[model samples]
Target: MDTLRYELVFSEGTDSGSSAGDVVTVERTSATGPGGHPVYTDPTGIIRAEISDQGEVRVLATGGHQDPAQGVRARPLPDAEERS
Candidate 1:
């Protein structure tokens, strides 16, 4: 599995209200979604995202409550770490 790290920025608002404008770590998973897009997971394990080859992000719910994050932007991170 090829692992990569990213910084996810939420400028708008999220499902969970607390995470708006929060920056979170997102790691690439071995799994792939539609069109062979790579799947990523947050440190909280509540946010699952599918990033397309074109850099489009599709957030997936884990059937639980998560901190809200509005307009999201994904940035490549040199290192990956869990943060609250």
Candidate 2:
């Protein structure tokens, strides 16, 4: 088993002001394969988030590769005026 480190950066958004940075740590584990074989892997993943100037929150992460399958997409956090 091993530990993985990841860094996340948040740039200024259309509404949100800005953010410093985020650090993440992940632990690996082993599992059984389709054929009942042992497989040791640490699947890649992606973290998605939305931030608003008013501090509204709507965020989530997908446990998988950071590739196309991750569907890494995000839109500006809606402003109070747009929430109506």
Candidate 3:
């Protein structure tokens, strides 16, 4: 129900990969599990931002059926960091 999307803004980068402020979208999907199931769980065990890459500034912990890359977690770093 809640469409969450980060307002991406490309600052600077080469012509190789994603630039700064790419406006990536965070998708939420129907997850069939004890966490989501109200009867099975209190709906609290759902994992959120815990650990991540060392250099990543703001990582997108995206997943669920809404995304094409389901199950594949991606933490797209800044444009400058990608170069390195």
Candidate 4:
């Protein structure tokens, strides 16, 4: 069993209607790693996410599971690009 740890940081104005400290849903799936190894052993499931006051997104995963190296990454949307 391998343990994976990571954090996502949001800039600001990520959520359209919701405020900064809102929770969001996230999902992950099983996939092969860079060396072609079984990463995740379970189907994807929805997880709750929270945005900090400083516009930072954080995800907490329970259980000792290996995260897929190449898969859909769940994170808060960053600030939109300024239109010229």
Which candidate leads in lDDT? Answer: 1
Give the per-residue lDDT digits (tens) of candidate 4, residues 4-61.
2213322244547443443333322354334433232222343323333333333334
Total colliding residue pairs, candidate 3: 4
**TM-score, candidate number 2:** 0.20
Sorted by lDDT (best first), the order is 1, 4, 2, 3
Error of 2 at 36 (Å): 45
Error of 2 at 22 (Å): 9.8
Q: lDDT tens digits, residues 1-84, model 3?
A: 222212223334455554543333222224332333211111232222211222112322335653212222234333433458
Model 3 residue 51 lDDT score: 17
Task: Encode model 1's per-residue lDDT on 1-84: one tens digit a residue.
Answer: 233877777665446666567677888988886667888898777877777755567776667565434457777766534342
Q: What is the TM-score of each predicted model, taking all chains together?
A: 0.65, 0.20, 0.18, 0.23
Off by over 4 Å in 2: 1-45, 61-84
| lDDT agreement of model 3 with the native | 0.29
Better of 1 and 4 by TM-score: 1
Tens digit of per-residue lDDT, candidate 2, span 1-84: 111221233343334553533433222225333443332222353433332222232234345443311211222333445569
RMSD of every candidate to native, in Å, equals: 6.7, 15.8, 13.6, 14.2
Model 2 alpha-carbon miss at residue 71, Å = 22
Where model 4 places Cα greater than 4 Å from the true spot, the runs are 1-45, 66-84
